[model samples]
Target: MEYSFGPLIDENSKILILGSLPGVRSLAEARYYAHPQNKFWKIIYGAWGKTPDADFDARYRFILGHGLALWDVVKCAEREGSADGSIRNETPNDIPALLAAHPNIRRIIFNGGFAFAKYKKYFGAPAIDYRKVLSTSPACAGRDREREEMWMEALGRSL
Candidate 1:
């Protein structure tokens, strides 16, 4: 089983971003979006009007300070390599428990199609509104600029 890291969240978080699962590089590095080509950080930092920090701790602090939280939809899944398409026998994260703990969270954003699908299958639709962005993984084919636009539109000044 491939296990996911604990959520980067706090009681004040107003938005939660969910991924299907961490890629192999991220898991190996014990950091989200660790793959050099992933646009997750770039989009977030850009939307926040800042440059992306190379330091993981600084990035973590930035996320929390901005009232944004990050986690995966899957707690564990059987898969090979880092591709979301390979995931199988997945177990979803305890999202309802998380919502209970952080009642301030008002929006949920799925970072990719896979995350949205898995969330719908396992958790159904949340009472809160949600948005889906194109995957930021290098494996995803969309243009980075368009993805950034979508992210910016969804997150706006909330980040």
Candidate 2:
């Protein structure tokens, strides 16, 4: 299947953001952080004191300004819908491909716990250095705005 949103990557990217899969809004809009309420945009903007408006282009620019790259773990996955539980056996893209392609990547920040849990095998004990694996952002489930802001600050420092 053709990807709705191509990865917004560059050779200068120092931080990689990974998610389990894109949600409906993301797929429909062909952009990452399409869900306005997802807080991904707000968190990133807040870290840099940018206003989180409804404009998608502006948001993407803000992210790119910070040298952040975005992508999902499962590039081609079968899901009844956007629900993570509906995901089935799927083939993920070659993450090492990204790693190799972007030699400047110094940190890998999983957006949520799900992606971390799913890709831990390849990332957990692998020979690849884990020092670049930053903490899971608090924008994910159970974490509130305050926590998310804290994570964003930490992430900014790493980037």
Candidate 3:
């Protein structure tokens, strides 16, 4: 079974960005968006008019410092590869627990359709609205400007 990464959340977090699961490269490196072609860091940092730092430590700080958090909907699963379509026998994360623990989390932005669909399957719709951005995985083919705009719109602020 493939396992997903733990959350990058804390008490200061106000927005939670959820991915379906870490890609193979990210899992290997034990880092979010570790895949070189993934635009997660770029879009996030660009939202604040800052370039992503090469140092993950700085990236982590930047995420939290901006009241952002990250996690995945699937905790573990059997999957042929990084593709969400390949996922099966999945186990979901305790998102309710996380939300309960961090009441400061006021928004959830799914990384793609998979994350949102899985979240609804496991957690149902909540009081907080649903928001989604295009997948940042290189495997997804879409306009980069559209993807970047989606994140900026979903984030809704410098917060």
Q: lDDT per model, in order? A: 0.91, 0.66, 0.90
Number of clashes in every candidate structure?
0, 0, 0
| Residue ranges of candidate 3 with Cα displaced over 4 Å | none
Residue-by-residue lDDT tens digits, candidate 2, 2-101: 2324577887678777777777777888778677667677677777776786777777776777898888777777777666666777666678887888
Error of 1 at 148 (Å): 1.0
Report the lDDT tens digits of candidate 3 across residue range 3-86. Answer: 988899989999999999898989999999999899999989988899999999899999999999999999999998789999
Q: Residue-wise lDDT of candidate 1 within 1-159, one digit each (tens)?
A: 999999999988999999999999999999999998998998888886899999999999999989999999999999999999999999999999999999999999899889999999988877797889888999876678778877898898465
For model 1, which pairs clash? none
Worst 10 residues of 2 by lDDT: 129-138
Model 1 TM-score, all chains together:
0.96
Could you tell me every candidate's TM-score relative to the true structure?
0.96, 0.80, 0.96
lDDT of 1 at 38: 92
TM-score-wise, the better of 1 and 2 is: 1
For model 3 the local lDDT of residue 149 reads: 82
- The candidate with the higher lDDT, 1 or 3, is 1
Model 3 scores a C-alpha lDDT of 0.90
Supply the TM-score for candidate 3.
0.96
